[model samples]
Target: MSRFHLGLIINPLAGLGGPAGFKGSDGVAQQALALGIEPKAAARTRTALECLLPIKQGLHFLTFPGPMGADLLAEMGFAHQVLGQVHEGPSSAADTREAVEALQQAGVALILFAGGDGTARDICSAVREGQPVLGIPAGVKIQSGVYAINPRAAGELTRRLIEGGLVRLASGEVRDIDEAALREGKVTARWYGELTVPEEGGYLQQVKQGGVESEELVLADLAAWLESNWESDVRYVFGPGSTLHGLAENLGLQTTLLGVDVIENGEVIAHDVSEAQLFELVDGHPARLLVTAIGGQGHIIGRGNQQISPRVLRAIGLGNLRVVATKRKLATLEGRPLLVDSGDVQLDDAFPDVVRVWAGYKEELLYPVGK
Candidate 1:
């Protein structure tokens, strides 16, 4: 049997800017590094690659040299062929594009890359139309639809493809936001292009839905319900999204629109906190995590809320999680279960199969949850 050829690429600085309040990592990796922000692209890529370990003997890996790809593969003991070289410093967008082009020329079965929208844009610019590619969600500005629901999902889907499972090919939109505008509290998302990706609705994330929730009354009701149910001394961690932002406004709490915030005793205590800070705040305290599904993606965790790390989730406990979304948003999922990719497989698996979603005032719907 012929071994399947797999191409791997990792953008080393892909997510450095997210927790550092730089909005995106396109050109601010150095600044983020200077501010002590650690990059997580390699760690996230490792999670995706772990699923393929069982079939390593039947696969041939091709990747760029050094931090871009080969370093992690070597550390994990995956035998792979290095295709290109990295210069003296951090890999740039050109390196990513060059890696994609080289991988295409090598005629690999699929190219698996780890990065945010900027990296997706690089791949889109270099890959030929209809070529198969998949993304591991390792970046901060994950506005594009190319990424899997999480790192593990990416590995699982790749494994399925190598194992001859029924995986269809579909076009995923490549969208990006203006980081400068995003820093100024403005989200300017534009559709750059699309890439062909492995399609398994349960494994892949949909294009992030833009615009405000059309039903104003539903948000008002959600806010009222949350306010009425506020528990004294219980810290409430608010994940990012339009729904949560609107709810914060309704409750007259000043919360960051696209960053994690904490509420205690009906007052905002921490705004735009990182994973370390969140774990510190919620560690020995009773906390409830309030998160809403991404409008069209059906993801309640690990899409854009990486700040709510696994340890933080463990500290808060899974049972204390409160999911809020309009019925219309849930309808967009077309009956697919709400997904969670907390980066910790055990914790992701620990969530109950069924969850209660707060849709309106005193109204809750039993929804299915998936990993």
Candidate 2:
């Protein structure tokens, strides 16, 4: 049997703005530096690739030079053909497009890219309609449906696709939120384009659309349930999004619409915290993490809530996590499991098979959770 040709592309600078409280990591290089953000795209892509190592045989990998693609694969001892010119500084969207064209010209069977929605948009621009592509979730604003639940899931899907399992190609939407407006606590998401994503048992993500009228009503009901359940002794770490922000308002507490906030005894303790700050606030306190799903992505972690890092989740424990979302938002997934890419593979696996989502006032729905 012949080998399968797989194209690999990595946006090394993606997700740098996530932990720094930026809404998205687009062109905020200087601000990301000032906020001391570190690149996580390579590490995230490697996580997916690591999952494919066992079945690496009979799979021919094609990648770009240096950090754009080849570096991590070489370090992992994979035999891959590098394409395109080697660049010194930060890789641009042009580099991604060029790599996609090169891989297409070389007749690659599938392409896997690591970045958020912007990167997905780039891929959509370069590849044809039927070209199969998958995304390893790596950026801050992942509103697109092309990304796998996480890196491990990406690897699993890739393995299934290559091993001739029952995987189907579906047109996934590429959506981008206005970073400037997002920073100002307003989400302006628009449909950019579409790309072909691999889907197996409804494992792939769906494009996010913000809450509608029904979801808004459900959020109010969910807030009522949460407000009545609050404990004075437990410190609550609230993650980002309008859902949580609305919940905070229902409790008469102010919250940063795009950053993590902490509340204890009905008082705001910390606002717009970093990962380090989250660790400090949760230390020695009975803490509970209240996070809402990204409207379209169905992600509770590893999208814009990097402030709730894997370490923080481990520290708080999964039992202390309270996920809330409107039933309408959950329905957007069409029965696909909610995803978590906390960047810690083991921690992600520790999540239970199903999580209880507070979808309405005193109403809960058991939803499947995936990594």
Candidate 3:
């Protein structure tokens, strides 16, 4: 009969560094702003909160002041109590910890934060073992497994939590890497502490697995087939990851290992192109998107390669899309469907059935793709 109390926190600068080409959004907010990059945490948080609006009557919100949290809830017509103050400048890690401590002291049932792994680490540092915390992924390079597959999924999980339908609260991984080294093309992710999260089968994300042994032979065979069938005049957009990087290497082309690249006539045309550049490139030319799913996560879009925006996907057309992954990588998914979060809900709903994935030379597997 009592009301459900949910604590909320938002790191306004969580995703500002992503599109600005910074490896992570940690201490690079000012630099990203100087480069004309706007913060996305607020918008992303709104998307999640909007999904929870249907059940607003039964829930009472506890959140931080201003843009840090309460503003979005208030704007959405939800009842909430504001916690500690955040000064006019950027919100620091200390502010997040203070908010968490205050929310815990207020006896909230759960805490929902909008940020990246850094924000997750802050929650882990502040909350006790049984304190429930969930993440609404609003950052670049989401190497951790604590986040939902997308903002909508996060909202769905929260809805179940508030309705008392969420029966499982499992410990999910909290991982992060050195942004400085990651920017230098060196990927070294370290495991941090775990946090209690609401879990729903096939809806929540699984922990991201570490690098697997290279599937060189299968990748080489796939590359050989690609080279032979590649259209002479068509442009191919290669998404990030080692799989696509291997394909680039097979063609003797240099690619930004962790950034999107464009190949045409067996040459690198646009190296590390942005979303706008991708839109321009695919305007008139026959283009195809060659992307691979993230291991364990099974996300073909919206993980690290945000440059391949939904607009870019529409330009290439779904028929022009080609997915490539090793058999070993597919095995890690363990029957979970491949996922997508292109930031367009309509676009995400367009493909609800299975899509063919190129697993090897003349090899194909029909994997389910969903939002």
TM-scores across all candidates?
0.55, 0.54, 0.54
For lDDT, the strongest prediction is 1
Measured on C-alpha atoms, candidate 3 has an lDDT of: 0.81
**Model 2 steric clash total:** 1
Off by over 4 Å in 2: 202-371
lDDT of model 1, residue 277 = 97
- lDDT order, best first, reads 1, 3, 2
With a 3 Å backbone cut-off (N, CA, C), the pairs that clash in candidate 3 are: none
Q: Write the per-residue lDDT of candidate 2 for residues 202-273, one digit (tens) a residue.
A: 322222344243656766777677778889889999999998898888778899999999998889999999
RMSD of each: 21.3, 21.7, 21.5
How do the residues 1-371 of candidate 1 rate in per-residue lDDT, one tens digit apiece? 23567899999999999889888887889999999988899999999999999988867789999989999999988878999787778898889999998998876768999999999999999999757889999988798999999999999988766553334566799999999888899989999999988766332232235334455787888788888989999999999988898899989888998999999999999999999999999999999999999977888989999999999999998878978877667767766667899899888877754455776776655555666
Q: Identify the leading candidate in terms of TM-score.
A: 1
Clashes of each: 0, 1, 0
Clashing pairs for model 1 are: none
- Give candidate 1 regions above 4 Å deviation: 201-371
Q: How far is candidate 2 from the true structure (C-alpha RMSD, Å)?
A: 21.7
